[model samples]
Target: MTTAARQPIVNDDMHDIITHVNEGHVPELLHCVKAYTPVQDATHVQMTAVYEDGMELEVTAPAGLSRHFVAYAVPGPAHEAIRGTVGEAMKKLGVKPDSRVAHWCLTENRALTAHFRRLTVNLGEDERADWRPGYACRFDVPGHEHGRPYTLRRVSGTTAEVDVYCHDNTLGSQWAEGLQPGETVTARGDYQEVTPDFSAGPALLLGDETALPTIAALLEGWADEHPVRVLLEVGDAADQRYLDDVHLPAGAHVSWLPRTGGSGTALREVLDALETPPAAVWGALEVSAAKALRKHLRTEYPDADVRVTGYWRVNEKN
Candidate 1:
């Protein structure tokens, strides 16, 4: 287990890059630092937060403290074009990247249903053990440039599991379909506080299939006095039935909202019309839905604690 700590700036190139970035020459800096591909090794940093100026990451290649900014104006969304920065850094250090991105090999892969696969990875002896529950890891399969965030289902020892919802014409679906043991894939985790804070009171867990694993973690170790309700949107009857199999905490009630094509539109509508707001809300949904819900919740229940994120974006051209 790698102990995460804050180390003084050891990489000189990193300091130089930050120096140029401070001069408001981010585009110029990117032109010089851009890598043709993601630089992979036995370890890499996981992005934790994004902002207009730069992004924050949890460095695993050399595990360190919480999050720190790598100065540069993000060209687009937080997840877009991040590898180039990481790759440039690794390359300058003369580290022969092992895989263009830090990756974990599959230890176990099982089918939960037609559309969901339970994938597991052993973090190995070299990986960090300070991982918390309720967060997600972005996975990138070989030959796929874009990555998708999959919630960490469970972690035991050095192994962790994630439930991937596979749909046709998706990169994740293709990877899961042909998955085999010993094959390595990229996994990145961002900042999501797993330390339960029910200080606001009972929580309302909401979202689609992507939110299930995270919701389950939130229910664990919860006090019996705290009331929790889950409002989920799934594709069909089979998806709903699968949720029933998961053993949740006491007094946890799940309401299944079935959709025809497994879309977030229905769920978004319900959330928009929701009259009763909970003391706290946690959700992971599609990009549009997550943003809309967050805005509405903040506007309506300004005092209620909310932590909602867009687990993935839809209709992306690339």
Candidate 2:
């Protein structure tokens, strides 16, 4: 039997191609650059970069696959540089300058990971105006479940505060842990969704940590004028202390419940306990809980003008 002559293996090292017989494909090397942009409600903008020319790219288009992109914001100077580099890379890929190609899904280029880490800020002692209680801040997070930035003012602590359920893994909780006092966060606009109209009537406000800031703001703005009833759900007893310490309007009746057993169980229990009809009702919480509360209120108190917001959704990052 004549054995077939063995074919020489072609190693494409110069082109950075690595191949495997079973895979039936070769990996190609490409160039990449780190770029960052500010998206509303994103504590720290995600950091992403562009790869070199002819580099195979996998992107999750709008209404497409789900994936994480590394994103972070930089100063004006660095932003300009990143934009230039990304432009050059896209030019090589034959993409138009104005194209929404930026939406193309690209992994956070690990090669520039060190640069991002170095850019992180640490607010050690300087008074962070943004973190102070009663300080107002706004964000513009589009496609965000909340859709709008309600007024937010710090309530319990000297820093800006937002409470999030451990189960609801959205950007708010992710950034809340790492948030520094002075760091800037983006919001949709200055438009106020529920500025307490003290003259409207007796008001009932309901929400969790996500709604706390707005609640605090409403209370502070209407303390001298409006009679408000506030109902809130918190993660645990620690959160209760935060609410207790805040100075609320004398007429404001505030109540709290722990959100542990289920998402909206605590809120539902509180709503069931209410005997008086509120002139207007407002609330914000995790999506499921908020939806549940909305449905219950609509069914039980049909006449009540209720505004319920899903501050964030579970498992969804944006």
Candidate 3:
């Protein structure tokens, strides 16, 4: 037998594979190490080599350094077998591929308004969380690496709901377009509570379409109904119905502003002309608008609890 035929072929891409895993897919690599290996606190991991049967991993944890060989039961080329083996390992270990990722099936996907889609997903057996306003679900959609966040409007017994504005072709719109009954969706991490303490008293809540779910949620769960003045801006005039179902306090009022100009344009006028400042101000809108408004609130209404978040930027993809 010739010496050249003695060694097995690795498809001649071992170096590329190693670099990809070491740099690009480090998070998934760490997940596998923590889930399968004994080292739960692995701070860092590196793929040193890839072979036909398995790959060599160097792990750094609190207990010190150690080397591990992640073997593959399905015999194939190193590149082809890597993903399958890792998935199988996770399945065999009875764990998710990543702790932060949770799979949910869509039960309801329908239009809440002319430009909005309400998506209701079934919670997992282990998930029975208490209901709250402004809890958001960040979807791990395709094409968007970091994912996009949609505020949760309701979380009933075994199901959670979020309203998505689907006017544009961005990641949010993409998710809405593809949503259907029984379709699987990946929600990353836990529900982020974005609502400010409404117990502070009468307040002013302002936002664009993206903040409707949160604003509606806050109103729906009105703690004492002190009084709330809401100024909402929507891209489409037809979206005013988004808040029609929200029952408000007797002293509260909601103003639907036209999206004549850029984000925060319509709402900015209302903020500047406030004769008597409310006890608190909460807003979530475009970045430029949020920054200017946030600064204005702090400087003008120094005594009030001013909370403004730049939810999205101009021309934001996700």
**Number of the top candidate by lDDT?**
3
Per-residue error (Å), model 2, residue 151: 5.9
What is candidate 3's TM-score against the reference?
Answer: 0.66
Q: Global CA lDDT of candidate 2, please?
A: 0.45
Best by TM-score: 3
Q: What is the per-residue lDDT of model 2 for residues 1-318, given as tens digits with 9 covering 90 to 100?
A: 111222222322211121111112111111122121112122221122222211222223334432233221222333343344455545555555431110111111111111111112222332332343333233323335543333334323322333322324444334433434345444332324433234556678888766776666666656445567788877755655545445787777888777756666888887777857765777788888877787787667766666676766676544
Candidate ranking (TM-score, best to worst): 3, 1, 2
Q: Relative to the unseen true structure, what is the C-alpha lDDT of residue 291 in candidate 1, on a scale of 0 to 100?
A: 69
Clashes per model (N, Cα, C within 3 A): 5, 19, 0
Q: 1 or 3: which has the higher TM-score?
A: 3
Q: Model 3 residue 149 lDDT?
A: 81
Q: Model-by-model lDDT, in order? A: 0.61, 0.45, 0.76
Model 3, CA-based lDDT: 0.76
Model 2: lDDT of residue 82: 37
lDDT-sorted candidate list, best first: 3, 1, 2
